[model samples]
Target: MDFNGKCFWITGAASGMGKSLSLLLASFNTQLILSDRDVKGLSQVADKAIALGARVLTLPLDMSDSGSIRKAVSGVLTNVKRIDGLYQFAGISQRSLIIDTPLENDRKIMEVNFFGVIELAKALLPHMIDQGGGQMAVTSSLVGKFGFPYRSAYSASKHALHGYFESLRTENSLNNIRVSILIPGRIQTNISLFALDKDGKEHGKMDPGQANGITAEKAARQILKGLRKEKKEIHVGGKELLMLYIRRFFPALFYYISSRIKPV
Candidate 1:
C-alpha cells in the first residue's frame, strides 16, 4: 500500500504492533502522529521514525483518560491538517473469569479498550468527513470474534467494537470514511503480560502461546496488506483463524474445542 505523504496516527506506539507498524510506515515516506502513555518509549519510537525519514509528532496521552484524549486530538488538529489513517492499537486485556472478576475490573477494561477507542474515533470523525475522508483501523483480538475463556470483559469490549465500527462503516459508506476492524489471534506482544487479573492487577507473565505467535512485524505487514485493499475486516493469525470459521459453520465442534482449549 502507498502511504507516501499520508498522515497516519497510531496508538500504543511505544511497543508491540503499533511500534512495529510505526517503524515500517516510516520507511514508506509517511507522516506519523504517534501516541502512548509511555512517554519514554514513545520518544524512542519517534526518534527512530525520524531517523527513518518520517515526519512524526509524538503525543503522550493515556487511552483511559478522556481529558487526555481531547487534548491529544486538539493537539493533532492544531499541527496536522488531515489524517489519512487513524489506527487504534491501544487496549487493555483481561485474564480473569467472570465470577472472579468484579464489575470494577470490567468497567476499567471497557473504559480503556472500548470507551477510549470510540471516543477518540468520534472526535476525529467530523474532521475526517469535512476533509473528504480517511481510514480508521482498530486492533481487536481473536477472542473478540468468539467468546473465549478468561476474557469476559475483554471479549465484550471487542464485540462492542465490531458492532459499533460495523455500523459506522455502513453509515459512513457515502461519507467516504473507511472503518477496518483488525482481528489478530496471537502475535508476539506484551498484551498478556499486562493483562488485568481478578484483582485488577497485571497478569505479569508472558503467555507461552502469545510468545509462540507471529512477530509484531509480521502481523503489521498482514494488517497493512488488508487495509491496502480497504477490507472491512482483517483477520491475522495462524491456525487460530480457523476458530472463527469453525464457530461460524460448525458450532457444535467449535464449542467442544472452545470448552477444552487452554486459555493461553
Candidate 2:
C-alpha cells in the first residue's frame, strides 16, 4: 500500500527495528505517531523523521502500564484523524531459565509483550473500523511457533500473539482490517542487551547469536515488503527460519537438536 500521507502508529519507536522501520517509512512520506517510554529517544527519532520530511508526533508510552497505553491512544485520536497502520513492536525478552526466573518476571514479560499489545489494539480497533480499514503488524518471534531454551515466558507471550491475531484477522476480515504477524528470528538489535533476567533486571549483555544476525534495517525492509503484500504472517531471518520447518515436520529431531543448542 502507498504510505504517502498515511498515518502510522508505532510502539517501541525509540530504538531497534521500530526505529529502523520508522525511518524507512518516513522516506515514503508517511506521518508517524511514535511512542515509547523513553522520551529522549522518542524525541531523537521524531527529530530524524521530521528532518526526513515526515510529519511526526511523539508520545511517551509505558507498555507495562495500561493507563499509559490508554492515554497514548487518546492522544493519537485527538491529533491524528485516522491510523492507517499500527505496528506493535514494544516487547521484552527473557534470558534466564524458567525454573530460576521469578514469577514476577514472567508476569512482567506477559504484561509488556502480550497484554500491552492487545490492549492497545483493542483501543484502536473501533477507530480503525470507523476509518473503514487499517493494517496491524505485530512483532512475534520464531520461538512463538515452537518452544526454546531460556525463553519460556518470552516464547509464551509470542505464541499468545499468534492465537490472538489469527482470531482478530478472521473477525475483522469484513471490516477490511488486516493483521500481519511478523515472526522475526534474530535481527541485530539491542533487545538481547536489554532482555530481562531471573529477577527482571536487564541482562546488560548481547547474545552472540543476535550480534551475528541480520541487520535491523534489512529486517525492517522485509517487514515492509510483507506488509505491502498484505501477508497474514511472515517470517524473516537466517538459519533460524529453518528451525520452524524442522519443528513442524521433524519434531523429534528438532527436539534433539534444540536441546543441544544454547540460546545465550
Candidate 3:
C-alpha cells in the first residue's frame, strides 16, 4: 500500500510496538489517528508525530469497552475524512496457571485482546468497504499460533483473532478489504510487566526473555513491510517464525518441546 498521504488508525498507540508503528508511519508522511487508554501518552505520541510533519489526531480510548471504541471511531470520522488502514494492537497479556487464574482475569484478557478487536473492526469495516479498499492489521502473537503454559487466556484470545480475521478476509476479499495477522515472539517490550495475574491486575514485573527480545522499532518496520505487500500473516522477532512452521508440520514433536520449555 502507498502509505504516503494515507491515513491509518492505530489502537494501543501510547507505547511499545504501537508507538513504534506510529513513528514509522509518520516517517512515511502518513496521517495517524492514535488511540490509547493513556491520554497523556497519547498526547505525547500525537505531539511527536505532529512535529515530524504528520497530521496526527489523538483519542483516549478504552479498548475493553465496545461502546468507547464506537464513539472514538465516530469522532475520528466526524473530523478526519477517511482511514486507509486499521491497526488493531490494543491487547493485554497474562501469566498465571489457568486453574488458579480468576475468571474475571480471563474475561478481561478476552475483552481487550479479542472482543476489542472484533468491535473496532465491526465499527470501522463499513467505512473501509465503502471506500473500495483498506487494510486491517492485527497484532497477534507466537502464543496465538500455539498454546503455551501460563498464557492460556492470552493464547485463546489471539487464536480467536486469527480465526475471525481469516474469515473476515475471505468474506471481504471481493470488497477489496485485506487482513493481516502479526505473530510476534518476544520483542523487547513491557508486555510481561503489564500482563495480568489471577486478580486481573498488572503483574508489575518484566519477563527476562521478552526484555532480551528484538526492539519494538525493528518489529514495527518488519510488520509494515509485510503489510505493504499485503501478506496474509507476518511473524516478527527471532526464530519464532520457524517454530510456528515446525508446529504446523510436526505438531507432536513441537508440542513435546514446547511443553518442556519454560518462560520466565
lDDT of 2 by residue, 32-149 (tens): 9999888999999999999998999999999999999899988998998999999989899999997899899999999999999999999999999999999999999998998888
Instruction: Supply every candidate's count of residue pairs whose N, Cα or C atoms clash at under 3 angstroms.
Output: 0, 0, 0
Residue runs of model 1 more than 4 Å from their true location after superposition: none
lDDT per residue as tens, model 3, 102-143: 888899999999988898898888888988979999989998
- For all predictions, the C-alpha RMSD in Å is 1.0, 1.0, 1.1
Model 2 misplacement above 4 A: none
Cα displacement (angstroms), candidate 2, residue 155, comes to 0.5
lDDT of each: 0.92, 0.92, 0.89
lDDT score, candidate 3:
0.89
* Poorly placed runs, candidate 3 (over 4 Å): none
State the displacement of the C-alpha of residue 228, model 1, in Å, after optimal TM-score superposition.
0.9
Query: Clash number for model 3?
Result: 0
Consecutive 10-residue window with the lowest summed lDDT within model 1: 255-264
